[model samples]
Target: MFNLIKNEWIKIFSRPGTYVMIGLLVLLVIGAGSVMKFAGVSQEPEGDWKQQTQMQIESDKQYLEEMGGSENFQTQYYKQQVAINEYRLANDIEPASGESIWSFVNFNSNFVEIIGLFAIIVAAGIVASEFTWGTIKLLLIRPISRTKILLSKYITVLLFGITLLLTLFLLSTLVGAIFFGGGDGQPHLVYIDGAVEEQNMVFYLIKTYLLKSISITMMATMAFMISAVFRSSSLAIGISLFLLFMGGTATQFISMKYDWAKYSLFANTDLTIYTGAMQPLVDDMTLGFSVTMLIIYFVIFHLLAFIVFKKRDVAA
Candidate 1:
């Protein structure tokens, strides 16, 4: 299995396009960092911390009142923000006053979507390209079982995705440190279960990135499954990319009216909603429910891919 995965990795790196994708990611991060550093983009709020906190609290309270004391998700979110801000003021713990390395890192987390795009592209092509180029027969002629071959390819795709994520995290951290100095030792504050909590900045950032990557990973898995089943890279890439970009929006629209939308892959892909950062799109969607939904989808995707690949006729 190790040797197979190594071979697959070597094949991916042997292509010039792979390097271009990686290089593009690096350039984008650096460009963003440069712009943030030189364009006078203010990462910190202006005015005295106490005044700002008080104003924010007032704003949240007003919004809540305007919500007519409803128990909706947005109402709950604003309440949480109010609580956290009140805690900040009562404890005399001012927020970070200036842009720091951690701030830049958090900003760069938006680029994780781009990473997902690239990973989906790779996943879409990895298996389909073998059949498109008439290399499936070559692979089938080997002594290895079909299941092992497919598993190796899938594992290679996952490893590639992880490599891109780590590269993004490490490169963003380096660029952030170069442009913005080290962190100011402020703990990330959150309001959980009606109580405020302080979390380590570095640990929070790491967890945030990982949670954000969950959607990307699921999309890549879907692309892989499509590639193996259809044996057409273009088709696989098109469908997966479309859903990757639009699935959440469509799901959100549906969720506004239908509670069943909570079972959607896109709805559950965002695990961060469970982390106290935001409210779930649909009520009653818990972390355990989302995880269970994701696992079911994951199993179904792999099953379809393996079953189709195992039975596919390569002799034609």
Candidate 2:
């Protein structure tokens, strides 16, 4: 079983597309960092701090007039602006824009949602590709039990998942730090119960990133089950893509008609969206509900995959 998993891992890493994906991730981080770094240095200073601050005040006043000045996120934004103006006045700090590229980089550094999807595709295709390419016969002829073979393939998918996630994390942080100035190491703030508090933002970011990785694994498992049942790689890919896009849409109807819709996987996919929507959708949500839905979705997908894969005959 161990050897089988190792061989599967080798196969996954050796694929040309794997390296291509890695290259793309690095390029995105570098390109994003470069754009922001230059943007800060290149912008002409908005000199005359007093005038600039007044301009912001007028802008906020106009916005308040437009919205009738409700106590909302916009109002909060302006309140902070007022504080910033006071700070600038007291300290004699010109509105000198420093390299905030690192902040931008840090904020976006953990966008592993789509990147992790690529990992899911690779994993889904691992066993399915062997079948598609007529290599299943060779695999089945080995002395290993069918369950052991499947377990090995699944373990390889996990290793592939972890490797891809770490690659995104380390590379983004390293490149971001180098291209931009070093971190201010401010507390990463997470919102709970409509209040923002200083917390371990870095750790939270990592935990969220890992959660995205798990979501990708769930996607892979979904594809694997489809591939196992349908015995067609194209069909598997089609189903995965359709569900990937439309799942949330379908869940919306359920939410309207039935209370059970909160448990849909699509509802949980974008943790960012669910996290006290900075710009919330109608009927804003709770974190507990989203987390619950995701857990059930994953468990059911894996259970279905195991059952169907174990029962299905390999013959084409």
Identify the runs in model 2 with alpha carbons over 4 angstroms from their true place.
39-107, 245-261, 273-285
For 1-316, candidate 2 gives per-residue lDDT tens digits of: 8899888888877889888877787777777777777654564455776777777767866776787746655665555555555545555545534554345544563556556566567656877888788887798888877778777887777777777678777776777677765655545444444444444546656766765665677677777766665666677777787787678678766676676665667766666653322422224556666677677877776677667767767776
Each candidate structure's count of clashing pairs: 0, 1
User: How many Å off is the CA of 203 in candidate 2?
Assistant: 2.5
Question: What does the lDDT read for residue 287 in candidate 1?
Answer: 92
Count of backbone collisions within predicted model 2? 1
Task: Compute the lDDT for candidate 2.
Answer: 0.66
lDDT, candidate 1, at 295? 98
Best by TM-score: 1
Q: List the residue pairs that clash in candidate 1.
A: none
lDDT of each: 0.91, 0.66
TM-scores of all candidate predictions against the true structure: 0.97, 0.75
In candidate 2, position 311 carries an lDDT of 78
